[model samples]
Target: MSKEQIKLRSMIITALFAAIIGVMAQLTIPLPLVPITGQTLAIGLAATILGARYGTLSVLLYIAIGSIGVPVFAEFSAGLSVLVGPTGGFLIGFIPATFIIGLFLEKLGFTFKNAIIANIIGMLITLAFGTVWLKIATDLSWVSALASGFTPFLVVGTIKAILASWIGIIVRKRLLSAKLLISNDIKQSA
Candidate 1:
C-alpha cells in the first residue's frame, strides 16, 4: 500500500470508530436529567487509538452530526434542541475528554499507571464541565448539580474508564503494529 492508501484507510477507520461512538451513545440507562451511556468509553478508546488531533476531530464530528438533527444521542434525541438542553453539558464535555485523554495517551504511552491517572483526570474534566453547565441551566448550586448530574455516574464511569483504558491500550498497540507492518510492506514494494 502507498501513503495515500494508508491515509485513506486511517480516515475510514476513524470515521467508523466515531460512528461506533455515536451508536454507543444511544444505548442509555435512563436517568431523570442526563442518561448514562457507554459513549465515554468509546471516546476514551478513540483518543487512545487515534491520538490527540484525529481523536478530538472524530468526537467533534460525532457531536456535530448528533447536534444537527441526527438521531445519535441517548434515547434518540437530536438536533440543536438537544445540544442546548439540560444534558448538553455532558454532550459538550465529550470533546475535552477525548482530547485530554489522547494527550495523555500520546505523551505517556498508556502504561497502567498513566492509564489510571489519565482516565481519572479526563473523567474529572468531563464531570466539571457537566456539573457546571447543569448548575447554570437548572439554577442549582454546585453541590446540588454534582449530586444530580455527576454522582449517579460515579460507579459506572469508573468501570468504563477501567475497561476503556485496558481495551484502549491493547487496541492502540494493535493499530500501531498494523501501521508499522503496512509501512514496511510499502517500503519493500517501492
Candidate 2:
C-alpha cells in the first residue's frame, strides 16, 4: 500500500476503536462512586491490536469526542463536567494504560501471556489513577477512595482483562492472517 493508504487505514482503525470504546462505555453497572463498564475490555482489545501509538490515539480520540459534549461516556454523560468528575481519572487513565499495554505487547510479542500481563498492569495503573482522583474530586480519604473506586472493581477488572487478552490475541491473529493488518504496522508503531 502507498504511504497515504497506510495512514488512512491506521486513522480508520483508530476511529473504529474510539467508537468501540464509546459503545462499551454504555455497558455500565452503576455504582455510588464509579460505575463499572466494559471500557477496560475495549481498551485492552484496542491496545493489543493497534499497538502503542495508535491505541493511545484511539483512547485520546474517544476522550476528545466525549469532551465535546457527545453522549459517549457511561450513562450517556459527556462534556467538561464528566472529564472533571470524580470518575474522570479512570477515563483519562485509559490513555496511559492503553499505551503501556500496547508497548508491552509490542516489545514482548503479541502472545496470550503478554497480553494478560500487560492488561493486568494497565488495570492497576487505571485503578491507581482513578483512586487518587476519586479522593481529590470527592474530598474523601485515601482509604475511602480505594474502597469505593479500587476494591469494588478488582474482580470484574481481572475477569475483563483475561477475556480481553484471549479475544484480542485471537482477533489479531485472524486479522493478520487475512492481510487486513500488517505485522510491521504493529512493530513500527511500538
Candidate 3:
C-alpha cells in the first residue's frame, strides 16, 4: 500500500482502538473511591498492538471524547468534571501509561514477554497516578488512598496486565498476518 493508504488505515485502526477503550471503560467493578475497569486492559492492548505514537493518540482521543461529555468513562461517566474529579489522575495518567507501554514494546519488540513487562509497568504507573490523585482529590490520608485506590488493584491489575499482554500479542500477530497491522513491531507514527 502507498503511504497515504497506510496512514489512513492506521488512523482508522487507532480510532477503533479508542472506541475499544471507551467500550472497555464501561466494564466496571465499582468501588467507593475508584472502580476497577477494563480501561487499563484496553490501554495495554492499544500499546502492545499500536505502539507508542498511535497508542498515545488513541488514549488522547478517548480522553478528548470523554471530556466533551460523551459517556465513555467508567460507569458511563464523562465530561471535564470527570477528568478533574478524583479519578481524573488515573484518566490523565493513561496517556503516559499507554505511551510507555507502547514505547517499551516498540523498543524491545512486541514479544509476549516484553509486552508483559511493559503492561506491568504501565499498570503501576496508572495506579500511582490514581493513588496520588485520589489522596489529594478526596483529602484522604495516604494510607486511605492506598487502601482505596492502590492496594485493591494490585492483584487485579496484575491479572489484567497478563491478560492484556497475552491477548494483545495474539491479536497483534493476527492483525499483522492479515496486514491490518503494519508489522510485528507496529512502530508506525500517526
Candidate 4:
C-alpha cells in the first residue's frame, strides 16, 4: 500500500476500535459501587491489534465522544459528569493501559504469553488509578476504596484480561493473514 493508503487504513481501523469500545461499554452489570463492563476487554483487543498510537487514539476518541454527551458509557450514560464521577478514573485509566499494552505487544512481538502479561499489567494500571480516584471521588477511606473499587472486580477482571488476550491474538493473526493489518501496523511508532 501507498503511504496515503496506509494512513487511511490506520485511521479507519482506529475509528472501528473506538466504536467497538463504545459498544462494549454498554454491556454493563451494574453494582452498588462500581459496575462491571466489557470496556476493558475491548481496550485490550484494540491495543493488541492496533498498537500503541492507534489504540491510544481510539481510546481517546471514545472518551471524547462520551464527554461530548454521546451515550457511550456504561448503561448508555455519557457527558463530562460521567468522567468526573466515581468510575471516571477507570475510564481515564484506559488510555494509559491501552498504550502500555500496545507497547508491550509491539516490542515483545504478539504472543499469547506476552499478551497475557501485557493485559495483566494493563489491568493493574487501571485498577490502581480507579481505586485512588474512587477514594477521592467518594471520600472513602483507602481500604474502603480498595474494597469498593478493586476487590469486587478482581476475579472478573482477570478473566476478562485472559479472554481478551486470547481473542485479541486470534483476531490479530487473522487480520494479518488477510492483509487487513500490515506487520508494520503493529509496530510501535517512534
Once superposed on the true structure, which residue ranges of model 4 sit more than 4 Å away at CA? 185-190
lDDT tens digits by residue: candidate 4, 1-190: 8989988998899999999999999898989989999999999999888878899999999999999999999899999998899999999999999999999988888888888999999999999999999999999999999999999988999998999889988888888888898767434222
lDDT (10s digit) by residue, model 1, range 6-63: 7887678768877988888878888877788878888877776676777788888888
lDDT agreement of model 4 with the native: 0.90
Candidate 4, position 83, lDDT: 89
The CA lDDT at 141 in model 4 is 100
Model 3 per-residue lDDT tens digits across residues 1-190? 9999999998999999999999999999988889999999999999988888999999999999999999999999999999889999999999999999998988878888888999999999999998998899999999999999999999999999999999998898888878887854534322
* lDDT minimum window of 10 residues, candidate 3: 181-190
Task: Tell me the TM-score of model 3.
Answer: 0.96
Local accuracy by lDDT, each model: 0.77, 0.90, 0.91, 0.90
> Model 4: how far is 76 from its true place, Å?
0.5
Clashing pairs in 2: none
Ranking by lDDT: 3, 4, 2, 1
Task: Identify the runs in model 3 with alpha carbons over 4 angstroms from their true place.
Answer: 184-190
Best by lDDT: 3
